[model samples]
Target: MLKAMSGKMCSSSSILQAQKLVDQLQIEACMERFKISLTAADLVRYCQGHRRSDPLITGISSSSNPFKDKKTCVLL
Candidate 1:
């Protein structure tokens, strides 16, 4: 995904893969590679980094998943 964006044209699959990332750092890396920027509020609304707490990589789980608790809410 990063390779495609950094090199030349990005395929549809690569875009799909990038959009699923929920890590702030990974998302920022993607944004940097694409040379895109967004405000904090817009970032939350357009990006899933703050909305989801999943692991950055596929098939991985968050190190500390608080959503397991019924009292936990993802909203800011």
Candidate 2:
């Protein structure tokens, strides 16, 4: 299965199809941990300029001051 789904040989559409099959097989819970691994890999690729934007990266970058405290918190 991995051979047929090799990254070098498969397009995004094929990968999506494979993911759907995996979902139907009810192994998504096992695959859940891989979501972070895949996101990290994509983030590394994005930082290296090998790929384009990801929502996770974009949301972090676009925030003006994510760490800022609220005015109410300051008065407390």
Candidate 3:
């Protein structure tokens, strides 16, 4: 799906046409899902790093993640 869209985006003659292709592809939703998942992973890493020296907080961040294969999430 993205590969086809990429070709269309590249072949687009004008900025407006490219923008229209992006809109038709719903790229914003894909981008937002990617952002949320990446942010969640980063947050987990940060908390684990900070908690290492501060024993007051204890938790584990798993290297194995179920969402690794997930491509999209529900948009809020």
RMSD of each: 18.3, 16.9, 16.6
| Candidates ranked, most accurate by TM-score first | 3, 2, 1
lDDT of 1 by residue, 1-76 (tens): 3345667888788677667764656767776443245465666675565435435533334555665555667887
**Global fold similarity of model 3 (TM-score):** 0.27
The top-ranked prediction according to TM-score is 3
* lDDT digits (tens) for residues 1-76 of candidate 3: 1234545644435666868988978866675455788899999999887876663464333444444644667798
| TM-score, every prediction | 0.21, 0.26, 0.27
Deviating ranges (above 4 Å) for candidate 2: 1-8, 27-76
Measure candidate 1: CA RMSD: 18.3
Shift of residue 26 alpha carbon in model 3, Å: 20
- Each prediction's Cα lDDT score? 0.59, 0.65, 0.64
lDDT (tens digit, per residue) of candidate 2 on 1-76: 4344444766677788978998877875655565878899988877778335544555544345667554544454
Worst 10 residues of 3 by lDDT: 1-10
- Tell me how candidate 3 scores on lDDT: 0.64
